[model samples]
Target: MESKDLKFEEVNEGFNIKEAIDEAKRCLNCKNPLCVQGCPIEHNIPAWIHQLSMGNIGDAMSIINEKSNLPAVCGRVCPHEKQCEGHCILNKKDKRIRVGKLERFIADFDSNMGLIREKLTPKTRGKVAIIGSGPAGLTVAGDLARDGFNVVIYESEPEPGGVLMYGIPEYRLPKEVVRREIHKIEGLGVTYVTNCIVGQNITVDEMFDQQNFDAIFIGSGTAKPKTMNLPGNTPRGVIQSSYFFRMVTLNNNGSVGRNEVPVKVGDIVGVVGCGNVAMDAARTAIRMGAKEVYIIYHKTIEHMSALQTEYNEAVDEGVQFLWETNTKEFVGERGRLKAIKAITNEGEKVIPMDKILLAIGSQPANRIVSTTSGINVDERGYVITKERPYGMTSRKGVFAGGDVVNTPQTVVLAMRDAKKVAAGIAQFVDAKKLLEE
Candidate 1:
């Protein structure tokens, strides 16, 4: 109900027909598009813009589909300022052609109009099992399913879309958009088995031996939230930003009740860290009617990991910034959070806060690797992936990408990793089947 009190509407809106066409027309269609080069997936920026400029929306969507399995999601969440738009020749002129908005427009237009019904490729290649339905998992499933591989996504959650469905806030990326992307992937002939977790209900070995899967992909993005072992610890009212994001989402979507959300109305919230997650937590707290929301970071603004735009918006939305501040201890009353003892550049200060959201960072969960052997991880628990196979694990026929293989990354980056892993899975499965023949 508190989350509902906060509109929870998507922040960015796609361009309308006229605006989209105008923005698309602004593109010079450079022979060597730096925007494409900047893109992790290297989408043909000029071509798609040209298509959109000419009013061929369907054609534009087709070109985008070539490189992205989650164009809509990318359009909504990708850090275009650091990537495509940042490289745009027009950005120097302060007139970058809203690439993200254009992409979002095309995707939204296509989805709303049912303009593209992709020809489903028959699953004749081989069976592939995908763990987690996050960006990485969805990308692998979509890519492989398109290549004639039978893909069955095993999601531990009741619904698919892993992190996309949970970690991200509704205001940033609406659940409907994630659902739409998952539906499109499903149309590619990918099967989804929800409430079934790998490494638990079924093991990677079971997927190969029992289910007859030729290859398996672990796209389980970092689920374990990292927290600092600080002084004056108390359990209640201290929440991980990831957990807060999930609970707020669940509460808003009616999946969970008000009692589940940690940040109550009129509460004073302090989020530790200054990444995008911190910004989200602070803003969400403000929206939830927090008396005050502060972002406490040990470094200055220049040292913050969150995008400049996000910081600016958070400030505009009334999020207070406690720069160069290090949290020393959690001051709690009766095992409940009451204040935070922190030291700042000026001097030591104690801030009264009801909930302290840890937006520090996260590491991969050992759940999947613990149950399956041969999948080696580093001292830090990241899966060891081979370069040749792109994202292949130490175990043959098993692959990993996204946060599990590398550090936790942006959705598009995870998608990019998953795409490479999809190619690797295809290659491995084909070679294995050939040898059997």
Candidate 2:
């Protein structure tokens, strides 16, 4: 499809029934599944594929649900090229099994067929307040809610899914898929409170002191984008990729209209960085009508942090790359961006452009830590937690996980961290309850 035609449409057309079964049959069902070992959440790959091969897709989905709450989302956006499929034995023969495609197919099939059986009731465990409805938070809520914990997710945005809702492009991951996955969690009796920024509207202390939540899981993801100290950073068209993506997603969902995003038709776009976010920004810029979209990175292509598949997709979509390039300044006229001056190994060059999107990276927003006392964060602003105790923060009875505790990572990795912290929280809360008894 042409770049101009890229809308909030589903990117990969999911597998149909026959395709799913055929793909599942490709799996040799290795006795020792290295694919599962490579997965962050350690999903039962062989088991699920075996079930699918047996024509029991519902059972396959149930097996998948044992470890994943956002299978459909992960199936769509997870960098399987580097993880599961990359480690597949089939790759040795230059024939990697299409694990991600198969996983997505099963999740999509289950969703369409209403095959996700409810696994929990509200008759056990105490109430837990989960802050931030991102991957980690949502995973914790889903797992705990399924274990009969009254899980309540608090989100700052109007929607429930954080990065899944805003950061990811619609063409890469459709909004409907996110909504469907979230609806499954809601079906498990999880409550959601949107438009509520925790630590501002409700302090962490209040969650325990006044609200009396038995436990708390802080998965508030990193929100503050890092920026270059280059001259003219304050120019009109110099924007962060996160903000740009948020605007694009909102515009696509009718939360706003076109022109709300800073980019315009026929514009030349310059994207700074070479991560997945950079690829997303460049592709989005092209789709937004940019005549040309350039990804400017200080490192070589091999050093790029973006997944190989993402880089390839961007190239396929006509996105350009300027490797080993560093921005010096953004030149503007009448307070709007007009061109960018950058330095490469060869020397300096001025690239005329209408917009510059910054995708350097982001840091955890420390607002919650600032508002709540006793919690400790590193000098770099990451929450400090014990490894053995898993997700316990500096203060007792408080747990933190996901991006807030580590560098910005993939959704599934963050979910893996949250799963560990959930076990920690369960242990801590269960011990406390025993002591009270």
Candidate 3:
């Protein structure tokens, strides 16, 4: 699809009722359920499939909710090929099950039918504050809120979904799905405070002293984009993939206008990196009317961190790839990127490009920890935490999880860690409260 012709159409057309039923019937309902084992969040794959096959979609959705708070978002974005469906027994026969599609189907069905009933708790426990409204933070908030903890999420952005609302494009993961999932969290009695920067506006000690939160869960994802130290990085046309994605998502969601989205049509775009974010950047560029889109990766195709399905989709959409190529510098004219100079095994080559999107990776923002004294971070800036207490940080009442601790992992994997951290927080806060009593 040409950029001018590209509507914000959803990439994956959701499964219809009949298709969902047929797919549910395909599940062998393996006793071992390797799909569940393979999932980072350990969704009850077999149980959900059984419920779906029996036409008990609400029950299936409930089963999915037990493990994941963002089923709809995960259904759209999670790389099932590398995770859950990757281990399906049917894969031995070279026929992998459509696990992602089915999960998406059930979740969408429940959402459309308004079958989601809030899971209520008996009484409120101690209060917990979650930083960031991304996957990990939202998961922790949902888990703790359901456990009767007064959970409040603080998001620095205007919206609460974090990366889901900013970094991901609407074509891949719709904003509506993100909004619906967030609504479920809010229904659980969790409060969200937008445009609230914890380290800046309110310090950790201040939260402990004034707010009196029993425990703090830091899920502020790695927002700082990792850049190539190559020359011309400061050029006008050189931009980080995260920033570009945020602009596009915000524009689509009406937070910004279309003119502010950047990357106009007919521009030659080059994306540096081979991860899923790179693919998203390349694809988004295509939809934004880029005449040519190329993904440059230093490693071989096999070593590319992006899921094969994402790569295939990008290729299908006419996005080009230059594997085994390392960018040497961003060649530009008058402070604007004009081309990219790269070195491959063949020799030095220069590709003319109007825009350079850096999707290399990201590092955790240090502002929060650097300003707060009690918390401890390693030389590399990752928070120091013990496994027994799961997500507990250097401070006794503080916990950290998700991309800040583990460099930008998949959304579901982050949620898995968040769930563990939530449990740990509950135990710690409960014990502390009991002692106080």
Candidate 4:
């Protein structure tokens, strides 16, 4: 490994066993449990914390597995400040119980000690084929597999984890943690097929009719990154933050070279936008040995979509923030990016930059919809799902959820949607089988 890659080691070292118990012991285990209400998937926060406090690692994991398939991933990445921990009763006293850290500790301890290995249920319910092995697809597969449905996930990448294994940076979420979680899911009788693109290699029709998938789920996330399309966007150094993140991850994992990673060492990099992705890109640039990394946002810090914790960490890591700055144009020459023309509060400013990474956001790709006949999408190409069956698409046996159906969301939000879709798929499959019998 390159000496520079050492900078990418996990920044946050979660609680030790003793520290976790001490923190978990502080949880009030409230009857109302506002933390549960705050969670997107309604995790039984109090129960798991209580279990961890008692050193019942297996019990805590069982509680977590009831609502979550990727406890370790969530423990690391979920926005605790805005959700569960935010609503903790102790927050009023400035003592929020450190729920995220405690959860991380429990998950790590459980995985390390092999405290809980669930018994696999027979796949007698039905066979469900899931597209994309992201948070949503894994949740659906785990949930249905527990309920006796045979689940197979098709992933286009070399590995099963979609964004978890690729899009997210290594420092925040280690690939090993992701692999561990996926390994747990696979233990539940779920099958994975990598390097398989749903739209191209096989179509929805083949899965439903030929391969005999009783229900099909689309959890494929937003693949097409959105760009500002400024005057000099076509320049060589102008890159999409998502693509940059994916390539850098691949490079770090030895699948690709440093040259393929896009951002080079000692480069002066400026990232456009102020969301989490923008923070990730800028911070990643710093770790890659960039001379300077700047986050250029048109809005004030008050309006930033990034978590305050993430922004604070980026600042601590020496990331420069350009706030309330409106980008006018990309000023470059020789087909390579060099500077950005913008207007700050003071007046017009020309910012010199060697590269510009756009972290604006993205939307779902039309690959599956365009290739399939029955599944319908909205004007913006998001799959149209019904509310009655919950995540059922226009076509009867076809279902869609996660970022593919709604706009791009956080990992936990995607899992929440996928869980509902899994239930809906189970209902549809059960009814069809009964009628045929």
Candidate 5:
């Protein structure tokens, strides 16, 4: 199917009502609840499962909302096998309860029924300025807004979801799902200000002095794309997976236009690196009508960083793997990529391709640290935060979390860090207010 047509349909069909209830029935309602312990936010897994099994869908959603702000998104993107489902007691028998799927079912059902969770708290706490509207910033905004804090999110991009809106592909996590989740947060009185670069448009001091924001949470994620330092001039066909994703999935209002598809319909595409981004790139190329898609990685399958399910899906969709292969150079004609010079276990190999996508990694942009003072960053430029307040930067009342503090391995992991930072922000805001009084 064409990518344009596939954009609206999720890769995973998700669970219907009957499937969700049957999955919920598998939950043993463990006394110790290893699934809850396994969750980063400590969601009451058994409680929700019990509610679902008893057909109280609304009550089950209420239980999930108590601790999670993005149940639908998390259920689709989270690495459940390594976290929640992996820790299930039934997993020993290979029948772990589908916690993630059930969560998605409840959240989707709520959204389809137009059943919005009621506003949690009145705007009482002082204002907070959150930089970046990604997972971490959204979590902090959602958590604090529920506690009556007036929150304003300043997003650098035209839209608010940061990586979630741009980096991840539509097949994996649909844009409408993200918008619905954002809408829920907005219902809590969380205001979003897009196209506002913190360093360029406004300063941290201005947030305090002009905006009267009592505290600042810096969740400005790692936006700088990392390259492989390949020889020769960077070719036209070579691009970062993140950029390529933004081009394809940003609904034609983005840099990549429908008329200017990055990979030609019959082009051969090579994706370097074996992470989830690489899988996404390869699969997207297939849907875009690529002649062939190759995931070239230096390591073996077991050592690949991508989720097992993602890798399996890529293979099912006709993506080939050049395992134990190290890329050396991009050979091209007149600035357009033509072939790749690589070395495998058997030595020199040349793989001809029309396009090469780099899915190596990314680093935090220096815009925030270079523009602000007293915010300590590591040698690699990640913001350094204290363990006491969990995500407080060296500069008091200025906090950082998610990929800015630690490059998140997954969306849920970023949410975990942001949840702690939200609690710290609340405590800091309350204390700061007491001192002023």
Candidate 6:
């Protein structure tokens, strides 16, 4: 059976006060608190839960805000099963406390009640320019701004939330929630320059020389989509998962419309790859009124990189999977997709498909590094950083983190990396000023 129709209004409604309090009571308040250790950003899980248990909603939120700037976003998307919740001692008995749900509860409660953090002190530390408005960029901006740094973020997209705004689906994370979190950062004196591509609109030297930024953080994530070099690849119906998702989810007041739609009703969609992106594409295709959605992967089900919960949800929503399959070519007629020529574990086969979405992988866009010197990237093109200053690139005052420095990982993991980079930037700025004095 198909799961409930996922509208734009968030699929998982966060816990209410009563439900949150009741659930918070489940925590035994372990002295060790393995949940905190398991957390990527090391949020004080037990302390927040303890506050929630005593009906201290604001106090609970205060505790969460100390570490996380995007609590609502992280609570919604983080893989708690593999991190915080997975480490709960209570899980030994299969009754672990729902930490992620309680976190979302506290964050949503704070926002719904218009509870905002007090404004920060004046920007006295140093000026830092952050490239990208993704989780990593936002994390660095928020953390540095709290330390009294003048921070500005340059985002290529029209919206400021980077992946939170465009890459992530609306069903999983509401756009309003992301906007609220960004507003909180803005209230802290961090400025955002939207529709401003750092390399294209402005150069790195300009940020340092003209803008007089003391330091730069490159958090522009991997955006170039990877594709299989196959026959008949030039088809009208072929699209990347990222592009399809944006076209489907972000158009016409945040709903799909007929003015310029990527996929149409009754189309048979075939999605390549078996990772989280592939699952998101397949499920989104189904939501867009596709007659059938198939997830084609070259690997077995066991080797699929998608999270089990996401995989299970897609299966529950009627997304079919073809395992151990390799596509040889995409056959089309009159420049439109018609069918896919493939080979399964058994033999050759042909799957008729009206539309195809590629979700194999992504690579870092070379725009920023290509136009700048002294910034070093690995042979694979990922930026190389130092261990001493903790995320500083070869360029003295420039730093890099997130997908620009490493492979694309989870959102919280990117935040974790950015947290360290923020600390490094603060230290570097302080030392530079001291030397000048």
Encode model 5's per-residue lDDT on 1-437: one tens digit a residue: 22221333578889889999999998899999999889998999999999999999989888888888899999998889988999999999999998999999999999899765675687887899999999999999999998999999999887889888988878788888999999988988999999899889999988888998989999988899898887768878898888777777754446555656687677889999999989998887777778888999999998999988999888877889999999998998988888999999999998898999899899998998898889999998999999867789999899999989987567888899999999999999899899999
How accurate locally is residue 115 in candidate 4, as Cα lDDT from 0 to 100? Answer: 89
Q: Choose 3 or 6, whichever is better by lDDT.
A: 6
lDDT of 6 by residue, 104-133 (tens): 888888988977566687899999999999
lDDT of each candidate versus the true structure: 0.89, 0.88, 0.88, 0.89, 0.88, 0.89
**Ten residues in sequence with the least summed lDDT for candidate 2:** 1-10
How much is the lDDT of residue 356 in candidate 4?
90
- Candidate 5 Cα errors over 4 Å, as ranges: 1-8, 252-256
Instruction: List the candidate 4 regions with Cα displacement exceeding 4 Å.
Output: 1-6
Per-prediction TM-score: 0.97, 0.97, 0.96, 0.97, 0.96, 0.97
Per-residue alpha-carbon lDDT of model 4 for 50-146, expressed as tens digits? 9889989889989988999988999999999889989988999989978778778888989999988899898998899999999999999999999
Compose the digit string of candidate 3's lDDT tens values, residues 1-437.
Answer: 23334657898898888888888888899988999889987888989988888888999998998888999999988988778788999988978778899889988888889997876785469999999999999999999989999988999998889899898889888899999999989989999999889889988888989999999999988998987887544678888989889888877767888777668879888899998899999999988889889999998998998888889988988888888999998887888888888999899998888998999888888978987888888777887777868899878989999989988887988898899999999999989999999
lDDT of 1 by residue, 154-217 (tens): 9998889988888888888899988998999999999999999788799988888899999889
- Give a tens-digit lDDT track for model 2, residues 253-342: 889989798888888888999989999999999888888889999888889988887888899888989998888888888898888888
User: How large is the C-alpha RMSD of every model relative to the true structure?
Assistant: 2.0, 1.7, 1.8, 2.3, 2.1, 1.6
lDDT of 2 at 116: 72
Global fold similarity of model 1 (TM-score): 0.97
